[model samples]
Target: MLSPKLEVVITPNRIAVRNVGSGATATADAPFSCSHLLADDIDILEHAAQGAMKQVVGGGFLPSYPIVEVSTGGRPLHQVERKVIRDALANAGASKVHFAPSVTDVDEQADARAAYIAAAKRRR
Candidate 1:
């Protein structure tokens, strides 16, 4: 069976996570601004992402690493900023990470994931 798929949305002050397979969702709010570019501290963003991941995954017996798709709310990230986000998701147990275009609705995110999966299969 394929591992679970996860979607993450990063905003300036909140991290939203959803399990695409299970429909479980979680939201983590940062005490301070969590923006990678505007915030004085970047760790807040990482921490919030970690927290949200944990909330979504819960205590289930995960068979494999979950695939993660992240959206930065339409903001473009620098290479370093992207690395930081990817590292945070990896730390939270994601095996493969993908960045999606700015998506807000759940259906839009799912469509993006489907397109990515299809493209990946073609490349293989």
Candidate 2:
């Protein structure tokens, strides 16, 4: 078994990565602050997050701070979501975990309403 090669792509507001020779990519918004660190073998994701933060801060997209504040675009890891994460981390042998809070997208309601309207129109 070998580690996959990762290709990092940094944008002004986004940070993304691709596994070399694979279609798998992971991305997150930039300028994130570290809320917690998990003491486990999940350092890959943590390192990627740090890299994205560095790019954004280094590029002057956001001010430099001791902690990188990442914006997760409103979807918070709570409720059922939190449960799913806890299960995954536990399964992965994570001894510790971190949680960062982000504002929920206010547009989710509007999006839902729009989808409902569209569906109604389609039915009509």
Candidate 3:
């Protein structure tokens, strides 16, 4: 989980996240999903949160490993969601990125995300 210093907000159509101390920010917008399973706002928010975390982690800092892996609810992201995530990453200066094809355990994923956020903040 993110530390108390991190903040995440979700709305009907968008989500925003940031590290409170470092001023590093990330955001993702809701895009239409083809499958009902991925239609919830929470799903979109999850996608956005992943994007935000990638930004905080400076995915664009090094071109050698430009493809950051995003999570997609343990399955492949829908075509639309994939495009949205890819576009967001590109806008953040991550020239090339892809989503993880498999899911990480829940607690483990949370811990990993927190670590990434913390590490990114430290760099600032």
Candidate 4:
């Protein structure tokens, strides 16, 4: 085996689930997921998510985030949800992950603003 250009966006965990009939059930959990990008790929994760959604969902696509917030790690989604997620990721640009709370701050805000401006200007 060899290391590739893939990125690991998730770590495995053990969690408990409640069944309608059974009281509780413990099972292995994976709260995070990653996209494998081809070599020298930028925004590989987004592309991976896009492709995954299309492959996973077929046509329909939804998202885990609310109508406003941009995120893939939210409540569970059905198969159709994946396509929505795919389009969302594809439509999302640098602004998507950069807007994260962990990355949000005065400096980050300035940077984001600058980026948005540049993108907007470029579009015109």
Among these predictions, the greatest TM-score belongs to 1
State how far residue 100 of model 3 sits from its true place (Å): 29
TM-score of 1: 0.66
lDDT of 2 at 7: 42
Residues 1-124 of candidate 1: C-alpha lDDT, one tens digit per residue: 3567899887677779999877889998885354345223456766776677667676643445789999877766656566767776777678888989563223436688899999999999
Q: Which ten residues in a row have the lowest lDDT in candidate 1?
A: 32-41
Clashing residue pairs, candidate 1?
none
TM-scores of the candidates in the order shown: 0.66, 0.26, 0.35, 0.22
RMSD to true structure for each model, in Å: 10.6, 15.9, 15.8, 14.3
Candidate 2 positional error at 23, Å? 1.5
* Backbone Cα, N, C clashes tallied per candidate: 0, 7, 0, 4
Q: How accurate is candidate 2 locally (lDDT)?
A: 0.39
Candidate 3 residue spans exceeding 4 A from truth: 1-4, 32-42, 60-124
TM-score (C-alpha) between model 2 and the true structure: 0.26
lDDT of 3 at 15: 50
Instruction: Give every collision pair in model 4.
Output: 61-83, 61-84, 62-81, 62-84
